[model samples]
Target: MKPKAPNVHEDGLLEYLEDIIGYKEKQNQLKDKLSERKKNMLKQNKITKILKINMENLLKIIRIATIFRGERTIRFDEQDLIDLKEELSRLERFLEIEENELKAIQESLKDMR
Candidate 1:
């Protein structure tokens, strides 16, 4: 006796195809988002590195100035003090902005997952 053929439902096929397409689209979107996030993180990392270097240099300058002051060999003019204060304030603002941006990115990543 010949074997009977199996039946294939068109509706099931359509549903499966739709699901696959949706899944693939979702995957592509995720990949794009991850790539963009990685690039942004790398850029941020570079900025952080530069900021770190700047902080270290600033600290070193302050330490040297302190040592010189202790020895009574150097004096900070009013303009010099004002400039240093402005620079420190600028750095503080930059750090606050970066922190907030990082927090936002973290939230976005969590939402993606």
Candidate 2:
């Protein structure tokens, strides 16, 4: 009797290669998306840090204004107060925007995972 040819399909070589290729494609796509997200996150974090620093500076200015007035008549220049308030408001708005961006990036990362 002649010996039978080997059953190539039974060895699963082709199937394994196909799976590996598919997995590699998926990994590449995920890596690209992750890199983009990381860049965005870094940008947002930097903005947040800047806004926090500005807010702290505004608070320090307000404290100094209060300290400058020690008598019963504690008076601060209206324009100074207005400028400080405006700066604080701007910083708060910037912080909010950065926080939202960070949250969105986190959500996207979670979905990808």
The candidate maximizing TM-score is 1
lDDT at 70, model 1: 83
Question: All models: lDDT?
Answer: 0.62, 0.62
lDDT of 2 by residue, 1-113 (tens): 11332475453555466567795577567667667766765776676577667656766766776678653322455455567667657766765776676577567657745
Which residue pairs in candidate 2 have backbone atoms (N, alpha carbon, C) closer than 3 angstroms, thus clashing?
Answer: none
| TM-score of model 2 (CA atoms) | 0.45
Q: What TM value does model 1 have?
A: 0.47
- Report the C-alpha displacement of residue 40, candidate 2, in angstroms: 1.2
Clashes of 2: 0
Model 2, which residues run further than 4 Å from truth? 1-16, 19-21, 69-113
lDDT of 1 by residue, 52-109 (tens): 6676676567668778778633345434555666766676676667667666766775
The per-prediction tally of clashing pairs is: 0, 0
Worst 10 residues of 1 by lDDT: 1-10
